[model samples]
Target chain A: MVKLTLNVVMAERNISSQELAKAIGITPANLSILKTGKAKAIRFSTLSKICHVLECQPGDILKYVDE
Target chain B: MSKWLKIGINVLIMFLRFGIVAGYFMLIYPIIYLADAFQNHTTHAILNGSDFLRFSNNQQATLGAVKRFPSWPYALIMSVGVVLTVWATIKLLKALIKLLSNIRDQNYFSTSNELALITIIKAQVMMLLGDLLFASGNQLSQSWLLRVNTGVFSETWETCFHDVFQIIMLAAIYETYRHAMRVKAENDLTV
Candidate 1:
């Protein structure tokens, strides 16, 4: 299963979900959905914005695990 | 919106309304007639063979007088059938109408349809019992409530066959619907 480490990355970057959501131009609810691992997929542009704001690579926020 | 499905639903709604009204009257008229007979309490009430269906089983009758009967038992014996037919049709209409609206809302896999199927099956079963009641009313009454006649028995047997066939078909329909609902739920959860 594809998993997200976005919550860990956000905590390490010392950013609250609402602040990150505003900086990335998405809703806090959507950010919370992604943090909860309920998101189906994240857009590349949104990922890019998150990476830019948090100063991290995509690899830091995404991981894969065998089911 | 599928045009054909919408039209079909509309037509079905119209027919259901008509059936509801017709069924209501069929049920109500007999009760009212019996009520009138009870209120009047005529000792010498000689009813026609064809018009007075409760006394239709009487083997002996003519333009003159053959037998006079009380009001209550005769009405009670025969009205079971009219009430059963009307009640079942009304229930069927309600379930199907709910199913239609659920479909219109794009909800195919639902418990409401299941409820409809169960009601349909139970209604048929009750119809078989009603047929039996109609038949037994004549015999058990011992020519007091209703007269003894072969026509009643023959009609009971015919309706029994029809009810059994309908029950079989309804069971098949319920099984098919359960399968379809299962498949639909799987599809919905695939994402």
Candidate 2:
């Protein structure tokens, strides 16, 4: 399973979904879904955008758990 | 600016709306089925053939009395179903249109987005097919074909779609992450 640590990162950074969405140029609803790991896939550009805005690595946002 | 991201957002929104509408439908299905089943039992003597005459006489009278106000609960449920279905359908169509437009505007493309678009289209098609099956009043008890139609399509299509799309999306995401890491590494090197 693919595990996303976005919620923890966001919380640690004090970043709101709306703020992340605004910074990444995505809707807050979309950001919320991604943060919640309901998103089926993410775009590289979107990842780049988010990493740029958050100043975090991809590993900070996502992880893979082999079950 | 990336078409893939826009398409992904649209797909995510559409999926969320679909989930909500589907949840509402599942919630009301039992009520509708029970009501219809009761009406069926009363009108048809198939439930109890031996007691048919006596039950029919009483049920006929009861049904006649019930017919006067028959439209209330069923009508309300049907109306709600129609409204939710229409709302979901509209949202789905809008999302699909936006995705298509994004595809059209793409100069550099992600194969993953194309696959995601196809998956979304297939999902929508399966949804419509399920609706058609239901509208035709075909139940699982009636035919195995009806029972497995959407399931078979969804299983075969969804697995393949998810697998291929996920791989592509993951690769693109990883590539972007790597590029960012490289840039960061270079910046660190310069400093």
Best by DockQ: 1
Residue-pair clashes per candidate, as listed? 0, 0
Error of 1 at B15 (Å): 1.8
lDDT of each: 0.69, 0.53
Q: How large is the interface RMSD of each prediction?
A: 6.2, 14.0
Residue B43 in model 1: lDDT: 19
The residue-level lDDT of candidate 2 at A64 comes to 90
User: Compared with the true structure, what per-residue lDDT tens digits does model 1 show for residues B81-108?
Assistant: 6577668778777777777777877777
User: How high is the lDDT of residue B183 in model 2?
Assistant: 63
Q: Spell out the clash pairs found in candidate 2.
A: none
What stretches of model 2 exceed 4 Å from their correct place? B1-191
Native-to-model Cα distance after best TM-score fit, residue B113 in candidate 2, in Å: 23
- Flag regions of model 1 displaced more than 4 Å: A1-67, B32-47, B51-73, B137-155
Instruction: Tell the DockQ for candidate 1.
Output: 0.07
Which one is best on lDDT? 1
State the local distance difference test value for candidate 2. Answer: 0.53
Cα RMSD to the true fold for all candidates: 7.7, 17.8
